[model samples]
Target: MARPAVRRGAALGLGMLWWWAVLRLAFAPGAGVLEAAVAAGGWGLSVLPVHCVPRAQAAGAVGPERWRGAWRAVRTTTASPLRRSDAGSGPW
Candidate 1:
């Protein structure tokens, strides 16, 4: 097993590689230009984005670091009317 320091360093390196891809795809002006650049880039460079973000997404999953754990739970309760009538049809 790698030492704690080694593992952390590896994780940091990999995370940097991930964010690099996210940034690249986000700023990319057009498909042709990005594709050409990736095709001409180093083997490792080409593989980074594929491993990082999903290829299936047209607009890739890019999120702020804070979004990682900025969750807030909300509690709301509403009482339905005792007497209710539908207008035959309405938006579901």
Candidate 2:
């Protein structure tokens, strides 16, 4: 109905506006590190890579879980790896 059409139009307009804002910032000066980081981080928005993983028993691979576990292990090791010596340290 007309309601659905209105909703679709609003969504399209909002999407275009969002895209414009991102592109503008992407090309703006003094927006180097911050803009580049935002773009790079947005790369995870695409799930095509996850879908590309082959399935074993059913759909979807177990790789994502394994990947998560690996990340946790890495975090645990790196979180407090280096210790500060307090032999004769000043009040910090």
lDDT of 2 at 9: 100
Give the clashing pairs for model 2.
none
Residue 56 CA error for candidate 1 (Å)? Answer: 36
Give the alpha carbon lDDT tens digit for every residue of 27-82 in model 1: 77653554445444544554675544453464755455445545433346576655
**TM-scores for every candidate against the unseen true structure:** 0.31, 0.33
Ten contiguous residues with the weakest lDDT in model 1: 66-75
Clashing pairs in 1: none
Best model per lDDT: 2
lDDT of 2 by residue, 31-64 (tens): 5655555555555454346544336655655667
TM-score of 2: 0.33
